[model samples]
Target: MEENKNKVVELLKQYMSTPENEPSRGISYLKEAVFILNGQGKTLAAHEILEKELRKFHDNSTVEMAILLNMMIKLSALVGDFAGAVEYSRRAQAICEAKNERELLTKVIINTSGLYFKMKDYDKALMHANKALQMAKRNGDEINAACCLNNIAIIHENGETGESGIPYLEEAVKIKEKHGMNAELPSSYVNLAELYYESERKAEAAELLEKARTIAKANENEYAIVEAMKYEARFLKGEGDLASAINLLEEVREYHQENGNKTELLGVLNDISSVYELMGDSKEALNTFKQITELSRSIFKEEQARSIAQLESSFEAREKLREINDLAEQNKRLRTVNEEISEKNNELQEMKAKLEEINRLLEKQAETDPLTGLLNHRKMKSVLDSEISRAERYETPLTMIMLDLDDFKSINDCYGHLKGDELLAAIGKLIRSSIRKNDFAFRYGGEEFLILLPSADMQRTTEVYSRLKESLREHLEIAVSFSAGAKQWKGESSDEFISIVDKLLYEAKAKGKDRLETSEAAI
Candidate 1:
């Protein structure tokens, strides 16, 4: 390795020392140096060397220069300087267009589309990807065309079209398989598996996922292996093996965290949190949520710093241009620079807005029950505390009800878990629609629910229960009923109040199912 590094250093020096008029002569040296550095996993070092040396030959528009810029584009993207990568891509693209270099131009367009995809500008990404696909097809570049198809499918999968991109991915996979493109098969298989899973084709998803894993293992492709594991973890969770799912995700989380992959780490942490929630470990879930929030803030800060650095670089370049131009041209250049600055500012604002939106969604997801779409028990405590305080302050009537589905276990046994889940979802929807806007409902636990009705007396609470029962029978096909307990608050602790209502529910269940027992009736 030491010998290889020394040789790379020598090659870079030779490339830098080559005369400006013979830029093509230096291209071999630069390419050799890059190849060596990449083998050593020192791409950042290679990028720095090339970027510093290339400064002296800015006037050269040779194919060599375009090649160097393209290399820099890939390096910048790898280092997470997407804005810089895009700038390099634009420069290379201009040279390719001017020279009518069709092959290199297609490659540059494909790379630009990938950069835009990373930047989350899906419209521009899709546009450039399609353009590259057309060019690749026209040139009979089957491999590049297959890659373009994969990229286009990914864009559609993530974009606002609400389309799964299954068709595009299928075509890409077929082409690669026909050509025996083993190097590319793993990724295509993984992508197709994800789409199949989303489309509810679990059997196909499992087959493709296994194929992806096997091929990735054979190729020693660590990235594809990890990707396959993530989906495997998801399948495990869906199968009710929460412990196995958590174990798989913990491995993925450690890998991403060690690699400093914040985006992938966030995803792993989210999956872990979900598994913890499923296991009824709210403490661990909450801790994971805190980690996610901290990591998200860290990513946002880094992005802001990168944007500021780019703006500073842009300012320096414009200053240099102003120094060379006449007064009139300088004025025109300043106007252009101001416009660019405005656009960048707008972009920053948009990024901030997006980050805020993501945080909002994360908070919502943490509080929500995934199966029933109701507030989960983790969110219930805080809401109950707040409502209790409000009721005390305003001297308003407050009531609580506990409802448990009658023979829910039998339902799960008679009709598989999927049918049980569907029934639960239907019941949750009915409960939500039956309650007043001011009332709060929660999926307290398996086969159980809790409703808090503020400013409602015992009679009103009973009426709400009656309405829910009626709605369930009217809306559901299967015969379903619940035993419920209702009570008006008597200035007791929240826990004590809940316990009393729970006992009342048991009393109703003891007497007969599908009935409501109220404090007023007992009195």
Candidate 2:
């Protein structure tokens, strides 16, 4: 490593002096130097090196688009420049999209989605992660899929949305193990350990952290090694080993200092301060806090200087231009303002566009039943109308299932609306969990949700309906039961198709409320 570093520096010095080496040797030397700096934990210096290289070779073919963008991603992430990271990821994504590089696209999406996560925008994170997951599966890129799953798990965990993330993390771990990705296992273990910790499984967390530490040390992964040490220090602190924790934190700080990881070193300083405070070493704690304050003040002053320079530049630009011209120019400006006012008046007369948009979205949402969060009658009709046309045009099988909660009104009357709503939501969750990619559920009417399964034959539809029924029976403890009436697509209008299932649904409700019924033939 020392030899490689010396050779890289020599190449950089050589390339800097010669114009001919600018494209090849210069870029190569810069890349190698950047890697070496990163290994030495000089992240900011490494970032500066890459930035200069990028500027020098703005359109050089020697530097691949993917490589440049990836460097940007890493540097921006290290500097906490999330917006810049997102922008670079977008550029990478556009290139990937143009080339149909699905795997690379997935990776870019994951990186972009991480920006949303850092900003505490879970919905957007989930959206991008899910999209990446779909694309990864389509491209059969298991590594990308695993990465997507892990990211989704992180979002879910942070959002505290039950245990939805557990399965995703578990699947990612399984994939990593199967693929012999030993280097990635430490991160997976750390994430899994966090999950176990949140789930109140301290023993499991401890065991996983131990495994993580072992692998990290064996691999000489400094970042993961610091994380493991931090985790162990935390564990010791929790166990009331204050002195031991302090010793570990100090040792870790020394390790990071040797590794040139200033950020981690500062973090360890903070940890040591906390431990000292807990141990009644007020002088040591105060000194540590003072150091942190000094660093913070230095950063703030740098930012203030930057802001002042930007303000001066803006002032110069303003001074270079005329604010207002002669009387004729002022008159012309007044006329233009009058014209804009007239346009605004005309727009106001047309409609309250923002209010109208909000109303339209609300109306669409209202067509969803509140309890089950499925489409109500109006929306279901709209969907059925579209699906009917699609089925006929493509000559593909489209199945409809009209599911009614049996004795639902009685249950609502007996258990009251709260438990009734719970039952409905639980069933809705079940349907959402059970459906295929092409299938959807909509609350057709009171206590009735309609399921639309495109490209499903009679047998497949029947099997799905059966599984749904069984799932509800096994999962729901409430007195509510569901009866479903199913039908395959025929050359019929939307209303006629729905009537067929409705008739069968009534038949099931009349005979018994917990059974399935289907049309023998299409209309």
Candidate 3:
């Protein structure tokens, strides 16, 4: 214990001493000191140092401010002070916005998006992501754009339609390629590949993911390299190579911890839990799951508690807004009751109209996919459900086809992640091209894609799938293949129907890995 204490002290001194050599090192040292102290079970001491250091600088330096803000948010979130983390993140975002700091603004937005995501506020998360993406585009920041795309894609993957998210990510890849920014390519490629896989385009997904791994190794971004390894593990799992997948995840976990990336370390632990689950080691899986739950709780509980104070402050602000709105309404009502105030009443009416218009815009924003400017998952599903009803009522045909990629991982591995992303974007374009005016395609999850064809029978569905498969192969000019499962719904529950098709997709993978399977009700 004495030896451990001495080592930690020495590390802190060494970290702090860097400022003497490089003046810009102070903030890094302060941030790392807190992280180190926290890891050493000195939570209170870490908090004290962080608070003191943050106060000393007032967060003026760009690098220091970003670091400080991230640390503050992380520590706050860890303690279950979500509201405080959000507030600090908002403050950081405001500062970036006020100063017209495009790069900083993107970083702050990413953090804000992350916080909202954890809260399951997908609407707010996408809002911030859209803001960041807009900033990236305006500034021509490809890396930032790619990061935003991946995050937005994750949202779509979770919401309902991963297909809707693909276009945004594809665009992001194009931007990365245009700029030759290779560092961020791996994760982006992996994301696109996952979408393809989920779409039952296993072959395309595998090809793209392989490309990501190769690129990571070539760039020697150790962190990204390890991440690619993790992705590879996931791909292997889908390929039924469970043992290899488990081994890869374990290796990644060890490497991440060795490198002291504790945040990633936590992810590795969670991933290990998943691998155990996959292996059917129920006991190990449960224990690992418990560990992750505890870790997450430990990280967020305090932050959530701290955020309560911030939440109260926000509630007060909201209440003030409500009061103002009420007064406006009352004044309008009084004006309507009287007649001499014609022009004033007219102006008030215009203001009210404007507010209504604003509300309408907000509603549209909530239901739409901000990245691709398309209908979001919830909206799409509602439309699809209605369409299904319409088709059934009329006795017309309705078919949904699941699309996925083939051997996409190899692209990420070979040409680099950026190139791999370029490929995905190109592929997304091809998929979109294959759709007719009446057809719709959505990102189902990860690399899995979905296409809905209304008033189409099984024969028509098969014809469209064949054409689409050929179109993608020719246009993408890659060994691209989609393992699709198509079904024409009968009198079965939509969930059951979708599951039947989804299972058929798995069967397709089992048969030859890059073929399509169609199943209809036995009737």
Candidate 4:
């Protein structure tokens, strides 16, 4: 490790000393250093170096900048910053498209597909993956073609179709093996093993898993090794070898934790929890669940911090630009005071527009739930209060629905909180699309949502509920149902209104879930 660190330091020094005009040469050195650092499991270090170097290149359209941005996208995704990765990918995609850099564009598209995959947007993921595959095939880029195939296969595997990805993955593995792509072999093998296991071809699955482990070990690919082990542990658990599965998962968890790979660590912890549950160790399972929750929160907080840092950096850049403009105005004052005033006014207008845009983004951030993209609890109270006031004053009917996911805890317990979050996000999108423009939806809290409909009584509100149910049935990949309580406002305070609806929601759950409960009396 020390030797690798020294090698990285030397490479970075060489890169820094390279002439500014020869950016390609400098980027080559930087890439080498990054490769070494990432191989050492120092991905954060690699990202930091890339970010520092990226700031030196002001022209985003440059090939060097696009390459650096692509690297950042991958590292950000690895570190569980899907939002940041998507932002970087968009910039990279724009640059590549404008420059007609198909090579970089293919990379960007594939990486974007990966980001969507991690976020569980299977439809988009599949779309992008297939697009990248076509592009790769057109360019006769065998390696990228194989990668695209692998991505597509995984998307199909995890998607709602319950279709086997064996064909796609088999093609990918064959391509890699034919090309002697040893580094890529293990992942393909492991993925194939998973499909084999799911198909109940246990012998083939075990053989593929062992091959993956052996190849990964020979390649000294720590990530691939742990990935292979993860699946092996799953197979062990499925075979009822609970003790061995737990031990293997613990080892996998240690590796992810040591590498600061929080995303994979979350998966490891979830697997551990599942194993414990299988072992009938409820106490241990709950403890593991708590750990997953805390780790998820930590990852969320880190992403938030990075966002704030980016905002601060943007503000600082604008401030510097303003200072430079002011200095130019002072120099131009000798020529004409009016001209200076006019230019200064124009600059002020630009600054005002920028500030307003920033304020809009900040406001949205404050009001929206990060996971679900719905109005959060922070905005819920004020919006509800205002709507209630409007309804009372105009004598228009207003209805609110409080809905909770049925068997949400079991979903979380069975599939982990990450899957639960995906379900909630899907439901949030469904609710948004199901409601009218005048209606409002908020992620009231965990596994619960609130919707407010203006100029609508219980009947209209029930219609909205029916629409949501139908939408969920058509769009959702998983089987999920929500119980809701809808009630017409009765000239009461917002708190009273919400309380009444909450009680009805509980009544729906008590009367056997997956149905709507509403006040039967007329307004």
Point to the candidate with the largest lDDT: 4
lDDT of each: 0.81, 0.73, 0.69, 0.85
- Which numbered prediction scores highest in TM-score against the true structure? 4
| Candidate 3 local lDDT, 1-523, one digit each (tens) | 4555576677668765665446456666566666655544344456556755665555474655665676666554433446666767866766666767779778778777766776667888888888988988898777887778877977765654323466667777787777776876777888888766654567887887888878877865555667678878877876678889889988887775554344455677887887788688999889878877876776566556555654554657789768767787668767565546887789999999999999989998987544434445666576677767767665767788876676667767878877766666676566666665456666565457777876667777787788787877676655667688888888766677667777877777767878888744321
Candidate 1 accuracy as TM-score: 0.56
- Whole-structure CA lDDT of model 3: 0.69
Q: Give the TM-score of candidate 4.
A: 0.60
Error of 2 at 361 (Å): 21
TM-scores for every predicted model: 0.56, 0.53, 0.52, 0.60
- Model 1: per-residue lDDT, tens digit, 1-523? 6788799889978977988677688877987898677544455576677767666666678777887788777666555566667778988999999998988888888888877887688999999999999999999988788888999989977874433366688989999998988768888888888776654467999999999999878866565677788889988887789998898899888766654555667778999998999799999999999999998787667657867866766757779767756465548878788889999999999999999999989998998898899999998888788778878876767899999999989888989899999999999898998775456899999989999987677877878888898889888987888998888888889898888899889888987889998754552
lDDT of 4 by residue, 1-523 (tens): 6787899899999998999888888888898899887776666677777777777765647877788788888788777877778888989999999899998899889988988887788999999999999999999998899999999989877875333467789999999999999888998999989877754567999999999999888877778888998999999987899999999999998887877777778889999998999799999999999999999898899888888787677857789778768788566655477678889999999999999999989988999999899899999888888877767765767889999999889999999989888988888898997775456789998989999887776777888899899999998888999998889998889898998899899889988999998854311
In candidate 3, position 4 carries an lDDT of 51
Candidate 3 local lDDT, residue 348: 95
Error of 2 at 137 (Å): 1.4
The deviation in Å at residue 467 for candidate 4 is: 37
Model 2 spans with C-alpha error above 4 angstroms: 1-4, 7-29, 60-63, 250-523
